[model samples]
Target: MKEVRLPTIPEIVIILGAFLALVFSFTLFLDLPIQLALFISWFFVIILGVRLGHSYQDLQKSIMDGITNGLEAVLILVSVGALIGTWIAGGVVPTLIYYGLEFIHPSIFLLATLIICSIMSIATGTSWGTVGTAGIAMIAIGEGLGMPLPLVAGAVLSGAYFGDKLSPLSDSTVLASSLSKVDILRHVRAMMVLSIPAFVITAILFTLTGFVYGGRNIDTEKVEFFKTSLQQYFDIGILMLIPAVIVVVLLALKKPSMPVIVIGALLGAIWASVFQGIDFADAINIAYKGFAIDTGVAFMDGILNRGGIVGMLDTLVVIIFGLGFGGLLEKLGVLKVIIATFEKKLTSAGNVTLSTLIVAFLGNVLGCAMYVSLILTPKIMEDSYDRLRLDRRILSRNTEVGGTLTSGMVPWSDNGIYMAGILGISTFSYLPFMWLSFVALGLALIYGYTGKFIWYVDENSPSDETEYKGEKVANDY
Candidate 1:
């Protein structure tokens, strides 16, 4: 293995500057696709590696290694594609939308959307699943209700990420906890100190927004027509929901996400045949090509006409290229060098904790993988926390809050791209309203500045005791 060293600040600025400029041009002047933009970004990182004395072959391997980091997510995109196809084909999606319009009042729909998605996401411990299934339906309902797509997308994302950040079942949460050596419960509790207020504030904002927008004023004749079309096209019944219910059970049992979602797709396909009377061959075909819904209603057609194995192709391309860029950055030690510079200034618990957020969030944005942030932030902050006498739980909490929340904000991130594609909103359009990210970031900065809950080194250190105003503190972890 080649030895990697800390990069100078100028090097960091050059690399980041080039990547950002390219991305901005793609979005602003060129109007190229995200995948293409990311592909170009990967080339920039590869060039950086080559400039740093790495071989072309080594950079090539670094790209592949970065791509490897997202293989699991790639598989998930495939399964979710199939799941969407089969679920809608089996009337599972229609059932949710149908019942939703009936029971979920339009005026309160935004608030309702946030609350239900939060509960479902937390229960399943998988944001993608919650978003893919329930989120798809929520967006459809938003369209049916005439609400702004970005607002609805923001509400849904905030709620979905809430569970993804705090739930022990969430991979990000587990990775952050395990990496920092904090018990899962302690990690969750420490996070709740900030997350609770965030959630409450978010819910209130959504509620207030909901009251102002009151979807009841919009004509629902089209949405009602959609439900009517669903009834006439196939057998819409309770049995169609079994697939979603089974997924809930499997998730509660701690089953792996890939198989659980695949099972849901399989069961949905089966239901399409047995109950909905779809031809067996056709049901299987839907899983591959997605359900083609062409109702005269444009909004309904848009909602139902999604999800198949092939549907994920565009997203897979973006993820591959994005990960390649992130991977190259990691292999070249760009991010580590930046973290090293930050570490040089850590003088107190507040400074260390606060700096950890900056490093972790930057890792999420620049690294393009939440896992990378969860891994790299802790590795870089380990010494600083010990020196400041902060508990590992604080590190764990900061890691997840920053890592999980920021991924969905960046337009090219794996999560961000997937969500924008699914919700049919631009990543930037919905980012502002993702209240969880805002609240979490705000609260982290507050904790960082105020020094509340900040622990100190032990006063009994024979040699180092005099360096810090150390005191006996209660164990938080």
Candidate 2:
């Protein structure tokens, strides 16, 4: 096997320039608006890629590859948009909110938010879907309950990410497991050693905070009005659930995503026409451009009205740019260089673990996309893990705990921005209360450095020279 070497000095400088440009673009202290910063960053990346021996054709190819890599994510995101619209059009979200408000005490709302999202994420295998829908509802319920916005946002993020890390349905989970050559189920089970403890600690903290905050008076009448408006606009029923069920069923069968999402969008349109009395043209329009309801309630408008291809375009754009940058870094060997420099210094299992955690975290901070971070980090660390005789599951878990958890904490990152925008809370404001994410990272680091729960491959393990019971067990790990 041929080993890839680190970057040359010029390549390092180019990589540094890309980082600086991205930082300058997103730096609030620089007094540049976010739009301008993003534009500037894109410009800088293009110039830097060209200077680093990438031709226009290469850049285009990179963009195409990046978009292709993210196609599944993109389809899921768009389906999520339509799903949110359908859920609203069918009154599913409003019903959840109304019922949530009735049952949840204000003091425990944050904790409840986390638990609910965690359950939904686990079931759906999609943190993004949980956030875009149930997460949105939770934010509204939190506001009605008078809980602090940041705390509510933090709790929602904490729960959503917990599921993303452990859920078999999650793309990040699947990606990590696949890249590391681990069975998906095994990967998820192995993560329990670290994930469960982090979740428990986070839940406890949120529960304590909820008790400290106490309950508040909610506007029952206002919530009732929103519920009434939804009921009036759309036919609310168990049948409205068909679209979600179909999507899940398809995903479970491991079908390609684009066709599934397209079907989902069609189902949304069909539901709108059949149940809401919307004309075919209007239903199609709503599915593509989002639904608009004249509920005459501002807060209701904020919560109940969302969906469409247009709504997902921003996130899609970000995914494209982020992945493009990551691909360029990979091609230039900049990421490889950094990982090699760090790997050479790690002599013990403890060091390898810590280094993996740090690498994962840095990838999140730099790439801000969980899949990008996972893909880049593992490739960089694969040889190191082999040298240390560490089980691949450990590296996979570390990557997930670091990348999937921390991406939502960085305001400028894709997940962070989406969570903040959807929840109507700033990432900075909610970051302090996002205890689970930080705790996950901390636990990973501790596990890495202390070797407390680090699993290693056994040297005395049998070779795959002979099969046992019609199966090869020696080479399984």
What is the alpha-carbon lDDT for the whole of candidate 1?
0.78
Please report how far candidate 1 places residue 156 from its true position, in Å. Answer: 0.7
Q: After superposition, how far is residue 80 of candidate 1 from its true place, in Å?
A: 2.0
For this target, which candidate reaches the highest TM-score against the unseen true structure?
Answer: 1
Displacement of the residue 211 alpha carbon in candidate 1, Å:
1.5
The regions of model 1 sitting more than 4 angstroms off are: 1-5, 453-474
Question: How many clashes in candidate 2?
Answer: 0
The residue pairs in collision within model 1 are: none
- Local accuracy of candidate 2 as per-residue lDDT tens digits, 184-283: 7768877888889989999999999888774655566766665576566667666776776787688667676556656766787787788778887887
Task: Name model 2 segments beyond 4 Å from true.
Answer: 1-18, 21-23, 26-63, 217-265, 460-477
Q: What is the Cα root-mean-square deviation between model 1 and the actual structure?
A: 4.3
Q: Which consecutive 10 residues in model 2 have the weakest lDDT in total?
A: 462-471
lDDT of 2 at 48: 60
**CA lDDT of every candidate:** 0.78, 0.72
